[model samples]
Target: MAGRESLPLRRLKLFQPLNRLTDDQLILLASRAERRTHSPGQKVVERGVRDGMDYFLVAGTVELKAGDGRTSKIEAGGEKALTAVARLQPRMYDVVAVASCDFLVVEQDILNQMLRDAPLIQADLDSMVDETSGGTDEHRLLMEFYAELRSNQVSLPSVPDVAWKVRRTADRENSTAEEVASAITADPSIAAKLVRACNSPLYRGFNDVRNVREAVIRLGTRTTRQLVTVFAMREVFSTKQPFLQKSIDALWKHSREVAALSWVLADRATRIDPDEALLAGLLHDIGAVPVLVHAEHYARLFADANLLDHALGELKSDVGAAILEAWSFPATFVEVARHAEDWQYECRQDLPQLVDVVQVAQLHAMIAAQQNADLPQFEDVPAYRRLGGLELNASRSLQMLTEARARVDEVHRLLAIH
Candidate 1:
């Protein structure tokens, strides 16, 4: 087969999103993309490699062979060529060049960052998606879940009565540390956890405070209430499905890290309350719990993590907001859970709120996860700006970062990560 001429950057069908990129952005992406040429019959990428690359066929054709032996040929400039199999861990398929071909490979992380920063790229992808199924099965499921939540048919998760009393006491204008402690004492398990948390390195006082009221006074009423509520949250993370256990554990782990980071970052901004930020971070991804719970009924969706992740990404925020409201949380925390993924969101305030702190903290968590990768610098993230111009390596930021890192064990204990 004859090779076709190369298309301009803006005209390449495999890169419709690139059309919206500024010249500088396009140049930067081109610099990062690894270009390669392959002859006919050459395998482009093998399955299960975890290369994390999205391949774009710039010229000629390639045959995609699924793990199940199904095959489809995608040609350059073809409508189907726009998207690679999205970040399918364990590599869902293998691409083999069917003719002399040119390819551009971009890392999945880099592309995701671009999509996050550029609404234009998202809009372009949405348009392409609209060409296919108007309402995806996963989306339909999310809609049904929302309707059920609103109708009170799906029975939202509720904390134990003891936890509710602690929250109510803390919400009062004249509530004292003694009252908060008494409420926690009503639940022995929660009281024990609160004592342990008070002794933990994250908030350990100068000396041990054995009594519940003394511990509450030492940790402050607000902190005590937050801990009590989160203690109840730890119990709900459990599931009967053995396979789903790992997913639940991972969700709690991520939430713990986010919470720790949020608490540390909150101290830097006066307007943001560390206790509120901590709770917000802990529950930011709370929507995933119910989604996973319902998914247990659909074995196919429940088993395929990549598919579930896709659905969660699409619906978690909306479900999270609903969950928070049902729990009677304040509007600020509810909005934080609802807009957890919106890193660029800015509130009209003199200083940042819990949402802003959680956003930046989440970014830090992401950076820590990609320990060995050449991840984007904190400065590149737009959220870093909204966070009071915070820097990961600055003197004050570094101090907090060091403290947060050292308290990882405490976070693990709080979230029951073990």
Candidate 2:
């Protein structure tokens, strides 16, 4: 086996967290990192040992053996390989090469320092990079997009007039259901959808509501306003371009799932408003809407799914916050949009907030879809512990969701209505 003095920067881009590093930072890390290879049956790492280096498998397969005699194999280029092997400070497993293997060894302190400096490094790069010239197509497009967004040149979706009117009417000190219903009736489609929602399985009563006014009474002013906004939000996800339609459809589907899960979690786990949680879940990714809409003008972006996903990952939070602010939504909702994907985010308040509920719900949705490769340990998520500390482990949480599937499905179906 051969060894290299310096790891390739491009190779660093393939791993999580490190993938987030700026090019210059990655180059600096690559120079300090070591690339080593081991033959089959060689020990890569020993259990219960505190090694300050992180081992990333670049090629071939490795096996991890715990003290309990349990073992798992991780192959290079697999989903699990995207992260370091047994990442804890004191190694929890004995790692051995199953075949000839390549691994990049990075000093823990150096890597952590670089990660901490990434934001500052990125800020400096942003100020210096010629957005018009150099860099990949994705980088150039992102720069242009950010420039437009900062200048308010990008178009943001507007909250429907009916939704705004209903919210305003509902917020009145002495407002009646009739007043809120009146505002909702301005948009006949949303009015009809509200009526249908109230009669749906989740909210169904012995007698069906015959009109918007009656629906408003049964669902209450707060719920009526929330439902109106939910119905109106469906329109914001539409696209005229055929190429972007699939992405829009997928986004809508994911939003609905998160919304349903958020509603259930808020109702069962915390005292937070279920309707508000549902709305937060739906709007969490609302920032991506304008990004896709803007991408319609860039043929190359939409054609390359990877580049499009990268753009969404990088820009969605900022765009979402802007959209929520423009819609005059609550600061809480704005916070949800901005930090929904931040697994490390935690509310400083004594109890969980809407953002916490939505974060747990989003992770549950990801778990249900078998997309947990890069996900942090369920117990490690601050939002999850805040919602149900120790009492709710991964298995129990999954069971809770299983029991609530019918309700989640009903909410999903209700929101899916045009």
Candidate 3:
């Protein structure tokens, strides 16, 4: 039997969703996960079969074939192999070993259950902290908070009604810009902001637009939907507790910067819609909101910044994914929320994805803020390479950002909450 110590936990952390797990949860996962091997030409997974398992390539190579004859290769130790081979259930592809291959096989149910129980596990661990040693009782407080979060007692923020209405109006078959404009008008503040944004350098035209209806017509329904959501996102970052306001403000600022960078990168380097990329960047760190909300109940945790940061770092990705999922966001935005921080994450697609744009944008934001000391080299990041035309050296990357400073500030000013 494979024990926790026998599993390659470090390498496993490179995988998505798994990268979001807490250290204790990873230990539990390692114990249940098993190692397997396949000889060259062996079938690793069959198309259209429900195997109830996820296969992570650990060594050698495998080829994934679709019914239509489309194929792709994943090589061990490469960024592409960091995620499961054909992750969808009732497998979308038939995976065959191209060389002798080593794999880490995790039962899907076990992994799901572990993820579901993560908050409870953290709560239990915090409950064990000794309180009599004059230490802060944040552990006990957090344990209670985590228990509430696990039980859904802690309310996750709802998608603002105006944003939801705009999405619904835009997504309806045959919906017009006029109908979407009506949705925006329900929240006059967002309506005004949308019109104002349309005039900003990010979307400026030869002539200025004066109203929500004209703004919607100029921006198109899809861009209007996204901008409405972006404009409304500020309300989600609020905190009633004065002590937590600074952290909330900082998070909002960081998200705006990343959103701005994502917009510029997508507009310049990829075919992805700049507005969609902007939305992805804005919501990437939204998971931190619930964590901060919970922490407000335990004011002492604020005194120990590391403890709060650790909690936010460990829990935000999963929480953000859940929040977006509940809001009916497309899979791409949900993916950005879940894996944008997975610096080594590589998409299966040949082209850059919204997540890739947001990831590179985040790195740029960090670099600009002088927080790149611990980040991966720009040239080595898979997302950076996928971006193609951009120069990847630190000086060159900084130069690109420098060139875009005016546009970035325009976006930031457009989206920043007053």
Candidate 4:
């Protein structure tokens, strides 16, 4: 696996779309690429072992592991981020040799420089991928592809630009529909999408929206801005985390259900905007994505353990807060997402309406989603009893549940899902 046969394993997902598709030039550069060899069962790169330079797998297989002793991803070049992370703080996932292997080691800066000529490399990858098929070695190629998709300068997705702009303008007292329209119009796709959503049953306008300005006026400044943020949120919510699709999807469903229930409950509970509560509910568990997505270890930890350990409890809230804080989300929303479900050790009696709103909303969503089977009884928690204690009495709780379902329907329909 030596000579000039080494290549940087740039998977299609890692490549910025701005580069278009360039795989051929990469293969060309890879042809003259330098190779580093390792004996079978040797450590190519260990977790927490930082190296500034990055390596491309020219040959062989490796397995990725995390701090928790769980195997991360099982591939060769897919395990190289430990070295890349050396450029930062403590390394994330660790890399280990699965068999005898060769790597085309490239400095991080050099790879960045080459990305300017992405079109050529994209072509090479396209061909290489086409030639690759599932069997013995094809598994390696797929794993590499999975890892590459996770690669990027930002390392995480951000809010949509169209939604962000509208929200920024909505901050001021002098903001107008015209201003919001001007912002969203920059992205025609987003503009059209927003108009459609505003006209949907959630907003409940009889007339169809023909333009952004009119839609903005009809939806109001706060609602309009919120809608934009929700639309932008899909990128973060919809990512395919490594080997954790089912887990990710379950979180999404839970969040979405909570969001819907919260919207309805908000109307019943307070003068607060229903939509605001929905937004809060939807994003409450948002932090877990980055934890599971970036770390790669959380999957194994959750999967193997039949019990939900207390140590892992902080993780969901901690990651949730981190995500919202990074997004510059409102402080109140951040608090709810970061702490609602967990048993806060320092809390006293008489739970406030807001905390109770979040706690109850989460519980209702879980029960409705059938995620409560494994969880303990709702009445056991003091806070749970405080929020009308889940009494199915035909008056207050039933009304909340009914309205919650209706609002949940609105959210699902707005997203065009069942």
Candidate 5:
């Protein structure tokens, strides 16, 4: 709820010449939208991420990248907003916000509420969808808008200096929570995001928390400290990069989904630490940032968005591996990152096996969420297959995972992880 300080209702483009909606309903809903900014070459949206309704480019230029790494540029008053054809799938490609742009980020819950109130948007959407077949003129116009954005610079964040110190500790099993907390505290912004999240309604009732120390104590020193680390990471490294931002919402959802599933998977399928698996699931995609960072404006690299998936498998295809290595994630996590897209680890190690459970369960939840293309190769994953083979067990795990996903979706949204 930041910018648009004086305007009544904003009617920015949504793809040219097809679906135009600047109704009072959309504007009233947009009144709830806050302004956000991004720099050039920064990854705005990471693929496979989920986000609520947002009328991006309330100001400034934006580039839209396809799943195959195909890039398109959009200028203000362009075709796509009118077209509504090229909305991003965060679970797939990064949408980098270029040129210090101002965005109108509307919360999902709010957007849904707004949609219910505004019948015109639905009408416009039906018109937009109905008007399309085999790449409608609207979609093409939006794609052209996307083409313009390709050259726009996206804002990306550089890891904080102390991030170097934390990655070093990853290799050590003997490392203590106190050490990590100390490092996290070094970055005030990280401390702030952590403290704010803990204090939010999500955890507000968990305890009568006062400060980081008390919050950490209430959550358990280890869990509390780990949350701090995550906060530090996003704070230090998150930027207005449109490409990276795409999947950020989905990544946040997926991580939480995996965390929820990890607990159940550990309870039923594997012998790994549920807490550790949760950490692994949440951090596994940390490698993605590095890939985007290395790609720069070469949005053309992923011409097929699914190629990013392939890139994950053979990260040698992308710079993800080196970025993970540089980010100082654990060797286990780094190894897990390497095998995350694959069915299993080459060595059949305990961590990788646990990671596989996480990966599969994430895909299962994604499939259930009905948000992506292609099912994960379940047959190839011996562990998940065996787990899935048990009727009662599989049903029970899915039940738990479904409930967890619901809880986490609510929780992360309340926390603004997207």
Candidate 6:
């Protein structure tokens, strides 16, 4: 069985690039890769299906026929042995095994995780993805989407009115805590949740806070602004479209967890404001809202989750950055949204930025969700190392998050009031 599992790695020369991986990372990655045998004259993949899996022929010959009738054969261990699919999603070609074949298949997300952990592999894959995307229709679509957004041809989401008022009021040089409280209290539902949040284990002070003013005072103006903004942002996530409801719900759940974890990490590790991290985490996936909205109008995208996810991966950051910019969010918050998924991204100085806090928090959230089976260890993720200062075992990290459950729960409850 072990030999069977390793066959794909051995036959395709993937073993060499994979040498950059540490033993633990490699084990995690290899475990997730699937090895298969294909009989002669069998189709490996069909054209026009949206798939993000990378496939490499390990043994025997494979025929590739493009949609335009161009054809080529990739022999086992040929010069192109190391290549996977040239274009990831909405496959442009039909691939078939020319003889009994061994094939290695890796999921796109897993490959991304490997690249994130192995910088050398990341560098190579970066070049590969860019080169492959050249002249592709998907590339053209992404560019056109970006151009439309930049030209305001597509309407971007607006910040909730309450979030806007709270943000603008808090931005004033002379803004007082009481004024911040007034802005929050205008929305009675949000005001009640803010009070409840102030009393939660995360922010509870000398006594139970009963009123919005007192809650704002206890949490302070900056945190109040962040809390208000996050509370208000929840309204924008709702959709009347049935197909996107599940995805939107998942997005919010993920966001809330990231926001809670970001607050904890920022409070513990860095000099940056915990509230800033909180807001950053809450809005990290805000770009998906627009994509789902567009998908609603163009119903075809609803039929394929892979295609939708790929589209989100391609456009979310730019769209998110644009939305935040439209809302006049702080430069740090806007930057956090723009680069939420960029784990290798570094800040100007040694101190971790809000972006780092959000990234680390997002990683922790993923770990908790058990969606990180193939991801790098906490120690290997660049954001965790930069923000955490030391590697933490899974147990230690889980303990920290567990201990903060009350606070995290409180944040979730507060946000869910809408």
Question: All predictions: root-mean-square deviation over Cα?
Answer: 19.6, 18.6, 9.1, 17.1, 18.7, 18.4
Candidate 6 pairs with clashing backbones:
none
lDDT of 5 by residue, 149-259 (tens): 221112223445554454444334676655655665676666566567667654676456555555554555555644545544544334468766665655566666665
Q: lDDT of model 4 at residue 171? A: 78
lDDT of 4 by residue, 46-75 (tens): 656556456555457766554644453334
Worst 10 residues of 5 by lDDT: 146-155
Question: On residues 265-331, what C-alpha lDDT tens digit does candidate 1 reach at each position?
Answer: 7865445777778788999999888777777765642344655566576657756765665455666
Residues 267-288 of candidate 6: C-alpha lDDT, one tens digit per residue:
7667888778888999999988
Error of 6 at 383 (Å): 1.6
User: Which candidate has the highest TM-score of all?
Assistant: 3
**Higher-TM-score candidate of 3 and 5:** 3
Off by over 4 Å in 1: 1-153, 268-271, 371-382, 388-404, 414-418
lDDT of each: 0.67, 0.79, 0.78, 0.58, 0.49, 0.69
Whole-model lDDT, candidate 5?
A: 0.49
lDDT score at residue 246, model 6, on the 0-100 scale: 87
- Return the TM-score for each candidate structure: 0.61, 0.67, 0.69, 0.56, 0.48, 0.62
Candidate 1 lowest-lDDT run of ten? 145-154
Task: Name the weakest run of 10 consecutive residues (lDDT summed) in model 4.
Answer: 80-89
Shift of residue 197 alpha carbon in model 3, Å: 1.3
User: 1-418, model 2: which lDDT tens digit per residue?
Assistant: 5355666677788885577678998888888888889899999889988878888888999987767555677799864576676665467688999999998888877776665455422543443333423445545555555445433457788788888788878877899888888888889899889989988988899999999999988999988888899989988998888878988999998999999999998877788889889999999999999898888877753465755666677778867876775565776887798789899998667878999889999998887788788899878889888877636667887888899999898888889776
Ranking by TM-score: 3, 2, 6, 1, 4, 5
Ranking by lDDT: 2, 3, 6, 1, 4, 5
Candidate 3: segments with Cα more than 4 A from true spot: 1-151, 389-395
Rate residue 32 of model 6 by lDDT: 81
